[model samples]
Target: MGRWEPNARGRLERAALDLYLERGFEQTTVAEIAGRAGLTERTFFRYFADKREVLFWGSAALQEHLVDAVAGAPDCLAPIDVIAGAVEVAGERMQERREGARRRQAVIVANAELRERELIKLANLSAALAGALRERGVDDPAASLAAEAGIAVFKIAFQRWIDDDDRDLTSLIRESFGDLKAVTAGT
Candidate 1:
């Protein structure tokens, strides 16, 4: 609540999400978000480049985590399996923040610009995954194909996760991967 609070970034994010939900993303401003958090506008700028960044600020870190997971996977695994394991680990991390993720998805769904930004973030993530696969000695089209498939698996599982309350994201991710494998195998 204080200007000097230790979790200024967290406080700002909470405040921004609250405002985005209450007033809509286009109607909210950085100053209002900062004020709601009992922080200064400068403090808000320090944590996020703009209000949209409040929703997308974690993209780079998530990408890096996935890349690291892929790179660290066992050499015996195929490219797709490596990606499967990486996305499952990512899903487990996301499963821990279900409520927050649900709310964030709601906000993104309400805004067209936010939706486009989300797609761009996903594309970047896919590219990063492909790069990681290539580094692991996967060939060009294979790396790209596996990366795109992995993103598709993540996207489908994520939507299912958002829509269903009974299933955990990790299971959804694994199930989606299995479905992909099944389709490719002509099952």
Candidate 2:
């Protein structure tokens, strides 16, 4: 209850996720999360916009990483290849937060509002990805198509990674991309 909570942001995030998994996202409140973390309600607001934000606190940074990866890729690569590179980078980052990512995904799936938010977040990321591709001199449907396809592959790979923690996320993403290719090939 003291004013100096070391790692307050991390503590708040852990507290919020715990409360969310315990009481359901909609059933939980900022005050409850703050109290659980042994902090003030105001402290919760300082870290997140609301209880729902606790699940998405890292999304902005994720988006930045995705965009950076896309831009950082070699210019000679095709649009899809560039997208795959970005996806691989993002997948590797996800691996570092595997357990937390799994818990957060479960929480998102359990709440309709959170799920909607997640879709919106994905849409934003897709748009950002497309923009990043365009910046790389990619044109029109190619950029949009690659971005959309990348997101689809990412969704499947992320789900599979969460379903079983045995495999690295980057590998799962690669497998998911292969699955997409195979399915589209009608083979």
Candidate 3:
């Protein structure tokens, strides 16, 4: 009800997720989300492109973080190791917001469109990582493969982390990466 609302972005995200969980993503509207957040539709637009973006607004930042991590990694590390470290750093950040991650994953899993969008985001992340590896002198195929594998490890670990409340995401990511290496090593 005031001209200046603190944390408008946070308020909008919370309202959108709550409405999506309550009424289903397809049934929720921007107007309803804005009303629930006690902000005008114009104010909501200032924070998010649309209602669906509320769930995915962090994708770009996450991608940037991963890319920067890989770029800053030591040259002695292998491509996969660089990716692993990057994702672990990301996991630590996500661990700080575990509940929000769980809720967002739930919303994405329940909707086909959202799941597709999630996949696209992952694909983009993988590509960005591969590019970073190439910048570090890693060749094709190896870079792409390592990047894809890293995303796979991150995805699996993220799912397991959300499902098991007792496990931390970084631990799960390490376990998943170890599993990947084991499978590749044929042992």
- Could you give candidate 3's per-residue lDDT for residues 100-143 as a string of tens digits? 89888889999999999999999999999999999999999999
lDDT of 2 by residue, 112-158 (tens): 98899999999999999999999999998989999999999999889
Per-residue CA lDDT of candidate 1, range 61-166, in tens? 8998999999999999999999999999899889988888988999999999999999999999999999999999999999999999999999999999999999
Candidate 1 Cα errors over 4 Å, as ranges = 1-3
Pairs of colliding residues, candidate 2: none
Q: Which stretches of candidate 3 lie over 4 Å from their true place?
A: none
How many clashes would you count in candidate 3?
A: 0
Residue pairs with clashing backbones, model 1: none
Cα TM-score per model? 0.95, 0.95, 0.97
Listed per candidate, the RMSD to the true structure in angstroms reads 1.8, 1.6, 1.3
List, in order, the clash count of every candidate structure: 0, 0, 0
The top-ranked prediction according to TM-score is: 3
Best-performing candidate as measured by lDDT: 3
Deviation (Å) of 151 in candidate 1: 0.4
